[model samples]
Target: MELTYLRTFREVAKWGSFTRAAEALGYAQSSITTQIQKLEESYGAVLVERFGRGMKLTIAGEALLQYANDIYRLHEESKEVVSKQSKGTLSIGTIETLAAFFLPPKLQAYRRDYPDVNVVIQPGNEPFIIDSVKEGALDVGIILDPPFSDPELHVNILREETMAIIASPDHRLGELSEVRVEDLESESLIMTEDGCTYRAMLLKVLKGNQVNYNLSYEFGNLEAIKQCVIYGLGIALLPRITVAEEIRKGQIVAVPFVHPECKFYTQLIYSKKKWQSKAFLGFVELIGGINHQNH
Candidate 1:
């Protein structure tokens, strides 16, 4: 069996979807399926079983997955050892919000110090980025709100962000200095999809207040949600840092909650067992130093 097939199987098992594995590896779905099939045939055992729209590993598959993880780790370590003798590259993952608002300057500094080091930036949502880091797909991930229950990872708090209610300038809530949760009962709301940290906080707050508001839409893309709110589709709750420029430009109005305040913490997360390259260490230092200096 090819080592590549084992790597593919590991990725598929980690994500629990052939389609997702294909996308992550930049392979066609058919190619991923064929690779897994060949691996199974060679072993004379089925590794995965279909479960709803996704797949779940059989008992044998789970055992192989454990071994696969260790093999992949050793593979990465070997590559790092050789690369250090020559040169090295850093693979960093970040959420869209940080990629847009915060990462550019840090990246510039990183490139300046290590002109020969290749830097790869993978952008995705919080969960995707975190999962990639946990699975050894990324060297490090800049994420918003640390994962709830992962003891194998280390998280360094980067910044604190406030959550605010946003609306177009002409919306009824826009004219208010502060609005109670009850006042939002009749307002149309646009929210991020489930699994988003902000979405969970917003729902908890609304539920706590016994507020029954109208939810018009749910989206995962920040820009799409912003555009919808800009066009007066509905009000939205999001991080203050994300809407700072829009609020300043008078494109949107940000209002504080009268009874409850919501906040989010941004963090730099990485696996505790993963080796941190010199380039990754430099970038982390740059971010930490700059934030400290400013404070």
Candidate 2:
């Protein structure tokens, strides 16, 4: 079967619409239909069935999708191996904290060593990054510890991270050696947006202990949250790595929160079934080197 036809079929299966698949693949709608027809004729089986305006995968289609993923993955791998040089884009998805603080030095190292490899970093929260990695839109993802696990994903625990309640030096909480969730109930808080993994974890723990607090400000940007905390607007529970520089500069005091659940993790996530290119493997190796030095 033609690789082009299989690719078109995968896209159509993904979106459940031939028009959408055509639009995504930059093909005419007629081309998509013709490719699928040719593929079906070659295989002598119906791969997709139409119900009204949408399409659903038949058993054959479902099976083909599995093979299609493997076929495309190996095709890319073959190209990378034959090229013998890293000259393609590496798409990475991550949360803001890592993008802002942790990844810079590692990224700098990567750029210096592999100047020809283009790197693109997309920053978002855990769910967005995880979904993008699973969908093959991103080659890899750095995500906060998620509440649940997916068997299809290969997750490497980069580190167990410490999260603390931070405030400007003169803030009331700064005087305390350790703080409690109950103590935060009466305080205004600066935090990441609602769906953030760390935010959700903290909220879940607080709810379990019946500790309620006000979200004075919500920011998707870690720097903005840090700035708000530094200006004494409100206290924030943030990863220690993100605020290490500020703490060292005496701009903020990171008071360790007293809770078992305050511990978080950073993970490197990728699809288990996806074939890894040499450049992708190189990046993963770089990450390992960085992690080793950090510890």
Candidate 3:
């Protein structure tokens, strides 16, 4: 069996549509259909069936998918090992918060230590980064806590981050060094969008305490939210790492919540089945070493 055929089949099985698989693989749709047809002929068995508008795997297809996954994983592992012997490249994905605050120095050290290896960083939100790694679009990801639940992915705890309720120096709550849930009842809250884990946790805590406050605004970007808060638009609860400079410059005041301190774990996430290359392993080790030094 041709390896290309198996690869195409794997893509189809992952996405459930030839069109989607072709798009993801950057192959023509006709090429994807041809590959599947050729594979079916070689196996002398029907592997896929059309269910409604989408494709469903037959028992034979399902069985083949399992083997295909294993084969692809092994092939990738072999490639990584071989390429690393020649000193190749590594790809890493990370969310914006880490990209901005935590990863720069580590990445700088990585580049200095492994001048022969190329490291690429792709930054996005947690969900986007996790999906990219699972789909083989990226080698690894650094994500914020409340880790992704995909069984195919592996997660390693990197560090824990503390969140603080912050406001402009002139804001009403800025004078207080520490605040309770009840103290926030009269203030408008600015937060990230619904998909943000930190935002969800903050809301859950507030709801549990029967604390009601107006949601002044929601933003996807932390910088924008910080700007809004800096201008006294509303109070925002955000990671301390993200707002440390502002606090130091006296632009904002950070007030820790008294009960149920808000904390998030940072994790390193990657496809469980991926072959760990030398460069990839080195990057992981670098991150681990940095965390150890910090502690």
Candidate 4:
């Protein structure tokens, strides 16, 4: 019956782990259990059930969750209208490149402007980020990807990131201003792990050209790939933004790979239906504003 109990229930449902939900909300695990118990009692139904190591909502819990979602959304909107509070959380799901290279300055500026806001950056692959945004778990999703669309999401292409095939400065391909698909014939390729969007793009370009290349190594991390290239392990395909500083320092050379297929953009995405708080809208505009200022 209490609004705080509803808030606690929502967090519990989101995490599915009393321990984790408590940590996220700064509550004790016992406190989380008590609140959920009260919430279930109010509805005269067991809302959550033990499932293996964690817990999940029962049929009743799932039904209650839908109404809880509506309640919280309206509650948040009402609070914003009454208090004009710009001090809530903004959770962003992003890929490795943006987290490490692109977002530092933008985040720093946002924090300075809205010191009361709590910003959370969650790093994951594109599919995970996309799903999180759609589920209302993440406030926004950012990626360096080719043009994308989802009927449920509002996708905005912030800017085009120049793609490049990077190699050690002293490598054989360094002299070339641009590397063509055929240029990589029989070359050793250090690749990102499967499920990477750009990896798929690069492989498509090579397979379409019938270029035979060796996969010397595969890494899921950006820095590891960069380190391998710096040591002359092999050439890699990555966004120029990821390697710009190394290129400037003469550790790596951006062999400026160009192809119509490999072009990717900085994107900002959010659910079309997700309630956008003032802080949420402010962070969104601040990202777009950075794009304009940079251009």
TM-scores, all candidates, are 0.78, 0.76, 0.77, 0.86
- Report the backbone clash tally of model 4: 0
- Give every collision pair in model 3: none
> What is the lDDT of every predicted structure here?
0.80, 0.84, 0.81, 0.87
Q: What is the C-alpha lDDT profile of model 3 across 212-251, one tens digit per residue?
A: 8999999988899899988989999887899999999998
In candidate 2, stretches whose alpha carbon ends up further than 4 angstroms from where it belongs are 1-68, 146-149, 289-295
| Whole-model lDDT, model 2 | 0.84
Clashing residue pairs in candidate 1, if any?
none
Give the backbone clash total of model 2: 0
Give the range of the ten consecutive residues with the poorest summed lDDT in model 3. Answer: 286-295
Clashes of each: 0, 0, 0, 0
Stretches of model 3 off by over 4 angstroms after superposition: 10-26, 43-66, 82-89, 115-138, 146-155, 270-274, 289-295
RMSD of 4: 3.5
Best by TM-score: 4
Give Cα distance to truth, residue 80, candidate 3, Å: 3.5
lDDT of 2 by residue, 1-295 (tens): 4999999998998789999999999999999999999999988999999968999999999998878877877887788888887888899999888887779998999898889889999887787888878877678998777334688777777777778899999988888889888878778888789778778877887889887788899998888999999898999888888899998999999988778766677788888766676677778888862233322
lDDT of 4 by residue, 142-257 (tens): 98788999999888888988888999988888889899899999999999988789999999989999999999999999999999999989999998889888988999999778
